[model samples]
Each structure stands twice: as C-alpha cells, then as structure tokens.
Target: MVRKKREKDQEIGGFLKSIEKIGNKLPHPAMLFVLLSVIVIVISHFVAKNGASVTYFDAKAKEEVTKSAVSLLNKDGLFYIFNSATTNFTGFAPLGTVLVAMIGVGVAEWTGLFNASLKKLLINANPRYLTPIVVFAGIISNIASDAGYVVVVPIGAIIFAMAGRHPLAGIAAAFAGVSGGFSANLVIGTTDPLLTGITNQALLASGIDMQLAPTCNWYFLAVSTIFLTIVGTLVTDKIVEPNLGKYTGHYKSDDSELSELENKGLKKALIGLIVYVIIMSFLMFPKNAAFRSFQEDIGKNTLKEFLDNGLIPAILLLFLIPGLIYGKTTGKIKSSHDLVEAMTEAMKSMGGYMILSFFASQFIAYFGKTNLGVLVSYNGAKFLDAIGLKGLPLIILFILLSAFLNLFMGSASAKWAIMAPIFVPMMSNLGLSPALTQVAYRIGDSATNIITPLMSYFPMIVVFLKKYDEESGLGTLISMMLPYSIFFLIFWTILMAFWMFFKLPLGPGVPIFM
Candidate 1:
C-alpha cells in the first residue's frame, strides 16, 4: 500500500510538472498580453481588409448591428490607442480596486492585526472547517466585483498559511468560489440583471411576449451555491491541497502567534469594529440619515444599490478604522505619518501588478475595440443554431460549449450578449424556456473562470500566489484550478439536467418549459 501510494504521488507530481513546464514556456504574463495585443492588431487589420463582419442582436442597444473589425494599425486607431493607454491602465477593474482595498490591508498587516485576530480565531477553531469557510466566503464574495479577487483570495492564502497548510491551495479554493461559482450566489448579484436583460431582449426580439425576471434562475443559483461550496471544499481537501504537498513559504506560522500587547491591540480593534458597525447601522437602517440623503437610487432594490456603491467604501472603512486603532494600540503607528507610510508600503507591493495591468489593459482594450471576442461568440452561436440538437443533450452541449468558450472570452455579459440572442430564441422554439437557457449559460460561464489566464483577475491571482511561491506561474494556477473547474462544470451540468428532468420552476413561477 505504501509503495502504491508513493507511485500515485509520483504520477500526479509528474503530470503537474509537465503542465507547469508547458505553461512556464509561455512568455511572462505581461509580455503575453503585449503579444496578444499585437496579434489582435494584426488580426483586426486582416479581417477588416477581408471585409469579415458579423451581424447579431445587441442586447444593450436592443437592435441587430453589424460588427466589423477595427485595426489599431490605422492612424485614427493608433491615435486612439495612444490616447487611451493611461485610461486603460487606470480604468483596469482590478487595478484601482485592489490598490484601494490594500491601503486598509497594508495598515492591518503592518500592525499585526490580521495576524493576531486570525490567530485567535483559528487557534480555537477546528482546522478541518477552514476549506468550507473559505469556499463559502468566495461564493458570497461574488456580489462585490473584483473585491473577492483582491481581498478574499489573499486572505484565504494568509489564513491557510497561518493554519499550517499550503497557501496556494487556499488561494485556489477562494478563486474557485469567487470566479468558478460566480453565478451561484445566495442573493442576486449584478450579473442577474445583466444576463436577464439580455435574455429578455432576445425573447422580445424573437417575437415572444414574455420577459424574464432578474431572479429568473434564483432557485438554481441558490442551490448551486450550496452544492458548489460542498464540492469546492472536498476538492481542496482531497485533491488540490494534497497535490500541493505542504507549505514551504517564508511567511512564518510563528508570525501569527499573537503577543500579549498585540492581543490587547486586537481587543481595541474589535471595539472599534463594533463602533463602526453601529454607526453604519444608524446610517443604513434609518429612514432619514445624512448618508442616505446624499445618494439617489430610483430602482427600489436598495440592497443592490448599497452593495454596488457602498460596499467597497464600507470594506475600506471596515479595515481602515480597525487597522488604525490596532496599529496605534500595538505601537506600530506613532502618528499620522506612520499610517501614510503603511499605505505606501502596501502600494509598493503592488508595483508588479501595476505593470501587469498595463499590458493586460491594452490587450483587453484592443480585443474589445476589434470586436473579436463578440465576433467569435456570435459565429459559434450561429453554428450551434445551425445544428438542431434537442432536449437534455442540447442543454448539456450548450453548457459545455459555454465552458469551453469561457477560456477564450472572459466577460460574462459580452459572451451572453452574443449567445443569448441566438440561443434564447433557438431554445425557446424547442419548448425550453428562456430561464432554462440562461441557467445553463450561467453554469458554463462560471465553471471555467478559475482556469482561464485571460481572465482580468488572472494576473492579480498570480501576484498573490507569487507571495507564497516566487516561481509560481500560469501553469501552476491552471493546474491548481483545473480540478475545481472540471468538477464544477460537470457537476453543475448534471444538477441542471436533474432540475430539467423534474420539470421544476427555476424561480418563483419561472417554469422550465414555455
């Protein structure tokens, strides 16, 4: 048995090493993006000269439009590219969000608050439950776009390291939950409306009078959240973590052991947290408050508005206030200058990310400007429409196709826009409801996110993983996340198939068949 186990371990290690070797052969991530941008520019010029164009329904515009390639090689294109370089880097979603969140994170880390508080909690808790907790948090963190990648992912690694486990395994688990199980949130996320709006537009354009509710797939989304949490937990414990072998990073476990003064500082931080929460409640709960009066949210879904607008600042403050008190109490910060220095130190760590963002932002911008992603998705959907696959097989194929395409296309709404117009109408004609189609799309869209290097947060995750393993690269991430992606895609497809078999309502009064 020992020999067999050793053989198995060797086999797994060999396979992973091979994958890493291939992945590492690729250029550095920043250069990879730079090369991709140049490729897009070349492809765009060729396609434009060839008059290659595609006409599809645009959900946002509520019309059918021809999408033609735009080459960045042209004078106008070159000028626009040059002009937008600063904006592209600055507007990169993860860039600003990560920097902002890290200000608080930096102070907390510098003062030893995160170490002390987490140490106190984990020291008393059972270590077995850590995987599920991280996974569950990742799933729920979907509501705050980019925040999970910036915050939960790194925190998961830190927590795991503190618990004497492989930090990369924790990072994988968190990224899976945050991206792989993205569509499965207990509460509706911004994705619900964005996707539903496209589905509804597709239905209307197809001459169907019915419209989809934002929560059309609520039942499936909520159930998948629970199942994914369970699956993610098991994969981390049984597959990913064991495969990681063990933690051998420089982040010392003894660093988390709280000193007496640090514990006292933690107590003060807790009190500050309580006061902050109480103040927030007075502002958020009351009908009339200075905070509420300043903002305008006509959509009645105050929760969405609050989460979308208020959550980040709330997260910033949640960390900042507690961090300030902790640092002062711990003697880590003697004055305002110390706090400023801490924030600067945090920004310093992100120097690598800032460079990565420049090339990545350019690639994303060039791709969008060329309409390459949209054209590919639209053409693929048209091909799928040409073939008349029906029933469960069709749904399975659709989910699988979505998962496959996700590796190339990262934007959920952009892919949905191209697919929805074609699939929603196509599926509805076969007696499957638009809600069912949307649910299948969601399942596929989410499951592959963790494994894709093209994802915007991909570089951010690499940066996080590098903190634990200096040489960790694209192959490392892909191999680590592949199991969760495959498990999620297959299991989610099966769950949706089961849901369809029962002829159940997808949400309140949202049936599977028209």
Candidate 2:
C-alpha cells in the first residue's frame, strides 16, 4: 500500500509539473537585475520630467524637482551611477563584504571545522529538538558573517535528509532564521556596524546633534532572537514541514565515518575557538590595551570605536585565528600552500555570486542615478509627516511602504541610504527618535528579503534547493518558503507595532520617541 501511495504521489507531481512551467521561464538573476534596472530608470526619467515639484530639506537643502519621470531620472543622472559604481569597485559593495568575510570562513569550512562540529553536535541532539536547534543556530550564525548562508543552511538540509524528512523543509527553516530573522540575533555581527555607520551618517546628514551608537537596537534585537526562534520552530514543523510532506526524493545520509584524526582536529578546533575568543575579549576589553581604540574621550570609548571601525579585523581574528590553529593541529592544513589553496577554493565557489553581484550593483547604481528611490521616499515621507498620524499607525504605514519599495530595490543599505535622510528627519519632526525610526526601517527591509526575487541571495537559495531535488525550481522553492515570509511580515510587523505602542526602548540609550 505504501509503495502504491508513493507511485500515486509521483504521478500527481508529474501532472502538476505539466500545468506549471513557470520556474523554467524565469529570467537569470543577472538579466533580471539588468532588465528591472532599465525599467526603473526609464520610469524615473518620466517621473522627473512630468511629476509635481517638491522641495527637500537636507544636505541639498531647498532642492526642487518635478515629479515627471524624465526629471527624476535626470536629477543626479550619470553622476550618481558613476559614484555608486566606483564604490562597488572599491570593495564597499555587499558582495565585497561577503567576499572578504568568506576568506576566514573559507578556511574554517575547508578545514572541515564547521561541518564536523555541526555533525558532532547534531549527532547528540534530540530529534524532536532539531527544528529549534537548527533555527537558533541559523540566527546565531550571523556573528560569523556569511557563514550562516554557506554553512548552517546546507547543513540543515543535510540533517533533515538524515532524519528522514524533506531536506527542502530544513532549508526553508534555516533560510527563515537566517534571512527572515536577519534583524534579530543574539549577538552583534558585521552587519550591525555596517548599518550603524550608515544610520549615523544619515543622522548626521539631518543636522541632528546626537551620537548614534551601533548597539542602539541591541536589546530589542536580543528579545527578537528568542521570539523568532520559537516562531521559526513552530512554523517550520506545524506549517512548512507538514506542507512539504514526506521525502521521496534521493538524499545523502550523514552516517559516513569520520577518521580519528578528523575527530582530534575537531576537538582541537573547539579548544582553539574558545581560547581565541578569550584572548580577543582580553585585548579589546581594556581601555589602554594595544588593540583598543586610541580615543581619549571617556564618552567616546575605544570599544565603540573598534566596534564601528575595526569590524573587519574583528571578523578575521574571530574566525581565522581559530581556523588556522585547528587546521595546523588537524593536519588539514600544514603548509602555506594549503592555506592559500583553501582560500582560493572558497573564491572559486563565489563565481556565481560575483556574476550576480555585478549585475545587482549596476542595477542599484542605475536606480540611484535615476533618483527614483530618493524621490519616492522623500515624497512619501513628506506626505506622511504632513498628516498627524502617530504611534502604531505611523509605524505600520512605514513598514508597508518599506516592504513595497523592497520589491524594486533589494539592497538594505542602498534603500536606507535613500530613505533614511528623508524618513528620519520627517519622523524626528513628528517626535520620533532616529534610532526608533531606523529600527522600523530595518524590520521592514528584513521582513521581505525572503520573498523578494530581487534579493541577491534569492538565486543562491534556489541553487541550494536544486541540489536536493533536481527538478525543484524557483516556483517550488518560492512556494515552500512563502508561508514563512507571510508569517514573518505579519507577525514581525505586529511585534514592532506593539513595541512602539508600549513605548519600549530599542536598546541602551535608545529612545522610543524623540
């Protein structure tokens, strides 16, 4: 009877496959970025030429521009594109951050430190607790930079396969925790500093007399970490995994034997990781330590400076030093050639990402050059501020607006770059703190990342799915993950609204309102 049921399921899948050939027809990510960019640029041009005139008060104070597409597109014109492209080439693009962070990550992954540790941990973990464990690990993995996407995600799939569950379900759960819960984490990460720097710049641009700390949203994010972990676990098991049904596809098991040396190496890696962290904490904790920031002002502490300015070095030592130690001890890497080879192998895996990023960067540059994002955000914020809306309604409206804009512009920093200057100031006028406003912006930006095809990581996720089921395509992956996206958008928005209504502080020294 079970065999017959399986056969029937396969037949049903075949029938549905014929009815939906949607995934195969989708454009390549590179082409999609290029095409969408051109469309937005053209629309911006027309908007600039014919749209109503409005004045913006900022660095370019008293700026006036028509709402016509042509006028909007011609606002900054080629200058914006040139500047954005230059920044991309200079390693400031998101791709650059991922690439640089992966050097250390590559060493760790190549030395089998990450995989072996995960396997060993999972081996002892209770099967019933796997969902939450994987989800939590995904969120926690953010501290290791792009390691969440590369390591936790695939391992989730593999673990699920070993447990006789659909691997895609595991992928969905992990992706939800990693990308959907992007703004929520137990620990600070490279993104925290990167985004805080941008937010600080925006605040400064508004002529605000304040110091925007990177940890401004830490408390709220920490709470959110717990919330998302529980919610992610529930949604994965109750909704996502069940909907995915049983695994009928071929999947590799994780019962393979590990060598004695590999086991010893993992043990050494664990010890090295702990020791490295302790040393780093010691070095960075003291005010006059060699590695501490050389700032003299007590208020302007060195720890803060290091958190903001020296994140790259922090990431390197946090992962690389431990990884090098593990490799040397484990015999995975004995010579300089081995180290170089590990890094080189990691770069080779990034070939697809580089291609995707090149087009994504161009699109983002074009979008900025056309000034559509700026014009829309400016006008939108102006309209909202003109009204007397306050508290929850205001936040809900902004979240929705942010989500809508996300469909067209995928880069969080880039979109915030355009929106923050206007929204922060506008919200400030309405008696809201810039930190609160920034947190709201982050929620909206993160909520939709899982659903948006325009996201740079979206294609990579699709690729990950194909590994489990050769026939799986964009539609299958999107369909499977859509529930989580919807749940996150609604639930996270509600949580933010509640937080606002309750007058909660986002983090230490962070205000709920201006």
Candidate 3:
C-alpha cells in the first residue's frame, strides 16, 4: 500500500513537472501582453474587413445595438496608439493604488515595524493554533495590500521553524491564504477599490448607468476570509504539513524578543492607526459631513463619494501615517530623506509591474477599442442562451473558465479588465448580476494562484521553499499546494452556491441574480 501511494505521488510529480516545463516555455508576461495586443489588432482588422458585426439588445439604451469591429491597424488607430502610450501606462488601474499603498508599507517594513510586530505576534502564540493564526493573518494581510506576500508569507516559514514544524508547510499555508484568498478579505483593501473602478468602467462602456460599490463584495469577502482561513489551517496542518514531514533546514529562527523601542514604535503606530480610523469615521458618518451628504443619490453621496473617489488616497494615508509614526519612533527615519528612500525602494520593486502594465494597458485598451471583447462576449452570450445554460451552472462554468485562464496570466487586474467587460455584460444579459460574475471571476482567480507557475509570486514561493528544502522546485511547490487549491476551490464554490441558493447579497447592493 505504501508502494502504491509512492507510485501515485511519483505520477503526480511527473505531471506537475510537465506542466511547469510547458508553462516555462510561454513568453514573459509583458511580451505575452504585447502578443495579445497584436492579436487583437490583427483580429480587429480581419473582422472589419470581413464586415462581421453583432446586434445585441442594449439594456441601458433599451434598444438593439450593432457592435462592429474597430480596427486598430489604420492611421487613426496609429494616432491613438502613439498619443495614448503615456496615458495608458499612467492610467493603468492597479498601478497607482499599488504604488501609493506600497509607499506606506515600504516605510513600515524598512522601519522594522512589521518585523517587530510579527515576531511579537508569534512570540507567545499557542503551538497548535500557530497554523490557524498564520492563515488568518495571511487573510487579514490583504488590508495591507501586497505586504502579505512580502512579509507574512516568509514570516510564516520562520514562525513554523521556531515551532519545530515543517517550514514549507507554513509557507504553503501562507501562500495559499495570501494568493488563493487574495480577493477575499475582512476589510476593504487596495484591490477592492481597484477592481471596483474597473468594473464600473466596464459597466459604463457597456452603457449601464449602474455604479458598482467598492463594498459591493465586502460581506462575501469577509465570510470568504473566515472560510479560507479555516480551510487553509486544515490543509496546512493535515495535508501540506504531512506531505512536507519535518523541517530539516539550517535556517535558524530569529525569536529575539521585541525590544523596548520596537514595542514603543508598534504602540505609536497603533495609536496613529486608531486615530486615523476615528477621523475617517467622523468624516464619513456624521450628517452632511466632509465625506457624507444627505442630498446625493443613493450610493452616490458623501460616503459613496468618499469610497469611490477618496478610498485610494485614504488608504494611502492610513498606511503612510502609521508607517511614518512607526518609522520615527523606531529611529528608522532620522529625517525626511529616510522616508523618501523608503518610498523609492517601494517604487523600485514595482518597476517590473509597471513595465508589464505598459503592455497590458495597451492590450486592454486596444481590445476594448477594437470591440473584440464586446463581439466575443455577445457571441458567447448567444451560445449560452442557445444552449439554455443560464443561472448556477453557467456561473460555475465561468468560474472554471477564469481558473483555466489564470494558468497563463498572473496579473489579476489585467485578466479582469479583459474578462469583466466580456463576462459582466454577458452575465447581466443572462439574468445574472454583474457583481455575481465578478465574484465568480474572483473565486476562479484565487483558487489556482498557488498552483500556477505563471503566477507572479510562484517563483518567489519556490525560493522561500527552497530555503528549507533544496530539492524544492516548481513541481514540489505546486504538488503541495495542489491540495489547498483544490479544497479552496471546492469549498469556496460550495459556499457561493449556498449563498446564491439563499439569495444572499454578495456585497452591499450587489445581488446574485438580476
């Protein structure tokens, strides 16, 4: 029986190895986006020349609209390409939020606030609950933006090693929650506003007058955070930990107690955070307040405006102020120069993301301009309508499709920019809510993040694992994570189904069905 199990594991290893190899052969993410942009251009011209167009009912316009290909291979298109290059990169949706949030995060990180706080957190944590704590922390780290990947994931390994457990299991658990649970969080994160912006844009492009709230999926995400935390803990303790066996690496745990200055810094940072929250609430909750109003449209007043227009900067300040306070208290920032350096380092890391965004932005813009997304979605909706696949089953298929697409594209925002315009309208037409489609996309995107080689952080995860197990590679990382990914997908989907059955809202004013 042991031999049979070994043979099965061998087979799985071989399969994952093959998958990694094939995935490695794909072009870099930026190049792939350029290639996709070129494909959209070619397809645009081809469709234009062939005079192919689709007539679909425009829900917002309350009329049948003819959607035709708009080729980007001509003089006018060339002008747009040239003139829009700078704006495309600058205006790429996720770029700004990531940059702004990371500034504060980078300061906190450089100042040793996060490190001190993390060490302090696990200093006295119960041995048995360590995995759950790590997993839950990973889920909550979403509120701090990408800090989860940069801090929590690696710290999980160190914490596990301190507890004499398999560090790789800790890494797996953290990565699963951080990436696989990326979209779900208890609090609004940079991603929430980022995605909502894109979703709202797609809605407008599709001529819908509806506004998508940043909190539209908040309730569902909070529930998902709890669910993923539990599942991640179980998988880490049972599946991933057992598979990894034990820690045999030479990496020592830095269990040094938090120093007086570090404790002081944390307390100062906490005070800053609490005060910031109070200020924001005062601005938002009071009648006719700075961030609230009585006369604005429902979901459009001061609070909504604050969320829609002010959320990104508000989050930036929230992190920046606390981080600054911590840095000053910890003596990490002797002057303004130190703060600037911290911001510079943060921006430095995002250089690669910016390059990728340049190409991805163009691809997204051209695809939208050329009407490819619209036509494809129209045809796709027609096919689904013809086949009578509406409701829950269709939603499940959309989730699977998103999951499959995620294997090739690592950038969540890029994938969603393309997919949302297609699926959102299509789902809306199918008597499903656009928010429902977005939720499905989020589910599919998260479930496979840990297992995909093409995921931006997949290599980083392997690096973390290799610190403990030199034999760790893409195959090893994927193999251990495969169970977590599978379980997350199954359980998350089941939860969503249950929610749909109960007619529960996915978020504030966001329903499952139209």
Candidate 4:
C-alpha cells in the first residue's frame, strides 16, 4: 500500500510538472491578449472572405437575425483600429469600475485596516477552533483583493506553528480559502464589478440588450463562502494535517498579537462601517428614498436603479469610510496629504492591472468589432442544441472546460474576457442566463487557482511554504493543494447543479434561465 501510494504521488507530480512547463511557455497574459487580437484580425478576414455567417432567432427582438464576420484587415477596419484606440481603452467596462472600486479598497488596505482585521480574526480564535477561523479569515480577505495572499497566508502558518500543529497544514487551509474560494465572498467586492462589467460589455457588444448588476452572484457566493470555509477546515484537519505528520522542523513561529492601537482603530472602523451603512440605508430602503424608484410599472423592484447604478459607489464608500476611520484612529493618516499619499500608493500597485487592461480592452474591442463573437455564439448554440447538451450536463462540461483552461491561463478576468464574449451569449441562446454562465466560469476558474503554478500568487504561496519546510518546492505545494482543488471542483460543481435544478435566484432578480 505504501509503495502504491508513492507511485500515485509520483504520477501526479509528473503530470503537474508537465502542465507547469507548458503553461510557462505561454506568453505573458498581456502578450497573450496581443496575440489573440492579431488572431482575431486574421481569422475575421478569412471568415469574411469565405462569406461564413449564422442565422439565429433573437428572443429579445422576436425575429431571426443573421451575423457575418467583419474583416479587420479591410480599409474601414484599419481606420477603426486607429481611430477607436483611445475609446476602446476608455470604454472598457471593467476599467472604470475596477479603478473606482480599487481607490476605495486602496485606502482601506493602506490604512492597515484589512491587515489588522484579518489578524484579529485569526488571533482571537479558540485553539480548538483555530482551523476554521483561519480558513474563514482567508475567505473574507478576498474583499481586499490580494491582501489575503500577503497577510492571511503567512499568518496562518505562524498561528499553526504556535498552536503546535503542522504549519504546512495551516498554509494549505489558508491558501485553500484565499485562492480556492476566490469567487465566493460574503459581500460583493472588486471582483463582482470586475466580472460583471466584462459580462455586461460582452452582452451589449453582442446586441443582447440586457444588463446585470455587480451583485448578480452575491446570494450564491455568500452561501459558498460558508460552505468552502467548512470544506477548507475539514481538508486541513482531516486530510492535510495527518499527511504532514509531526513538525520536526526548528523554524520559530512569530508570537506577536495585534497592537493596542490597531485594535482601537478596528473598533472605530466598525463604527464607521455602521455609520456608512445607516446613511446608505436612508437613501435606499425608504419607498421615497433617493436611490429607490417607486414606479408602478417596474413592479416590486424599487431599488433596481440603485442596485444597477449606485452599487459601485456604495461598495467604494463601504471600504473608503472604514479605511479612513481606521487610518485616523491609528494615526496612519493625520492629514489630507497623508490620505492622498496612501491612495497614490494603492494606484501604484495597480499599474500592472492598468497595463493588462489596455491590452485586454483592445482584444475585447477587436473581437466585438469583427462580429466574430456573434457568429461563433450562434453556431455554437446551434451545435449545442443539435447535441442536446442543455442543462446540468452542459453546465458541468463548461465548468470542466474552464478548469482545464485555468491550468494554462491564471487570471480570472483575463480568461473571462476571452470566454465571456463567446459563452455568455451562446449559453443565453440555449435558455441559460448570463449570470448563470458567469457563475459557472467563476466556479471553474477558482477551484483550480490553488493547484496552478501559473497563478500570480503561486510564487508567494511557495515563499510562505518555504518558511516552514525548507525542502518544500513546487511539487510539494501542488501535492498538498491537490485535494482541495479536487474537492472544490466536485462539490462546487454539485452546488451549481443544485442551484440550476431548483432554478434558484443567484442574486436579486438574477435567475438561472434567461
């Protein structure tokens, strides 16, 4: 049995190594977008020349419509390429939402509010209940984007070591929650707007005439946060800890707790959060509230306008208010200049994302201008119809495809930018909602993040691992995380199936079907 287990581990290690090699050979994500843009231009010219087109019934219009590929190689296309460059970058849906959201998030993170809150959650946990708290804290860290990777993950290791448990188990549990639960969160964060903007852009460019708010997946993802916290804690206590054996390593764990001032700041931040919530409630809850619309024609959906138009700013303020309060209480920010500098630091970190957005925006623009997305979606819908691949089986297949693609490409937004334009509309034609498709894509993208060496944070995880086990390497990290990835994929997919079977609303007014 021992020999057989060793052989199995060997095989798995070899397979992951191969995936790593192949994935590494792929271009940088920004460069990949550049390549995809070129491919779209070339393929569009060929398809247009061949006179290929698709005819499909438009449910919104209640009529049949034909879509043909538009060649970017043509004179008009060349002019568009030059003339629309600035607009393409500016009009990118995710650009403004992400930037606006990040500015607020930046203030919070810069104030050390996010870091202190996460540490407090883990530090105050009862020894017996530490695992779940670590996992839950990791999951909650998603609200601040990549903060969990830097803060929770290493702290998880230190906390475990202090508890006389295997630090790698701690790392596994925290990493599982942070990366594996990337898509699942209690509150709508930057990711919601980021993905929703891409989904809306795809639908609008494809002439779907429908829109979704950033909170479209909030209800389902909130539930998933609890579910994954349980799963991550179990995997750590049951599977991972036992496999790791006793900690014979001599690495010392940090025993520092949150400072008194930080605790004070956190309390004040909570007050700030409550005050902000109360203020927003007055604007949204009352029938005659500023954000609420009491039009009889819109039925019971009085807050639809706020949900659609005002949610982003609300999220921005949710982070900004608490962060500013924390900073003031902690003396992290004493003046307007200090506050400006903190915000500036946050923008500095976003320079890479901005670069990526420029290329991604161009790729999405090129894809839409060529009309290839519509043609592909129509034909793909027809193929799926012919094969009778609608419903659960189809959704599972898409999730698996997304998981497979994640092994090669790590960025959730980057992968979705390419996939959303094709699948969102195609799936809609087959009776699925854009929200449902986006949810499936997120499930796949998230489940595999822990195991993928290509993930941007993978190296950081390795660094955390090395602090406990000097001998640990990429294979060690992959092997340790493999169980979490498998279970997440299986159970998360099942949860998605459950949602589809019951036709549950994923979020407010967001249904499983179009």
Weakest 10 consecutive residues, lDDT, candidate 4? 56-65
lDDT of 2 by residue, 1-514 (tens): 9999777756645543443356546676568777877787777666765653444433222232333333324546656655667565444245655676678877887887766665776676777788888888888877755557766787688777766678898898899888887878877776776667666666677678776777888888898888888888888887677656677776666566667877887777778778877877887777676566655533444565555446555665566766787788878789999999998987887776677677766766566555566666666666766776777788888877787777666767766765677777778878888788887887777777777766656766766786677667666766666667777778877778778878889888787888
Candidate 4, residues 1-514: lDDT per residue as tens digits?
9999888756755665554455546665567668878988899899999998866544333345576778999998899989998998888665666667667878987898876775676565666698989899998888767667655786688678777688888898999999999999999876887788788877876799899998999999999999988888877886677666689887854457888998899999999899889998998887678887764632553665565556766777888899999999989899999888988987786676677677777777887777775665455434544565777898998888788777656667756766676678878898899999999989988999998644656644665576577666556677678888998899999889889889999999999998
Which candidate would rank higher by TM-score, 1 or 4?
1
lDDT of 1 by residue, 62-160 (tens): 888898877778997899789999998888877777888898888888777887888898887788999999999999988876588878999999889
Expressed as tens digits, the lDDT of each residue in 118-158 for candidate 3 is 67776777878998888888888876565577567877887
TM values, all candidates = 0.94, 0.76, 0.69, 0.64
Ranking by TM-score: 1, 2, 3, 4
Give the alpha-carbon lDDT of every model.
Answer: 0.86, 0.71, 0.75, 0.78
Better of 2 and 3 by TM-score: 2
**What's the true lDDT of residue 509 in model 3?**
74
Candidate 2, after superposition: displacement of residue 248 in Å?
Answer: 6.3
Which scores higher on TM-score, 1 or 3? Answer: 1
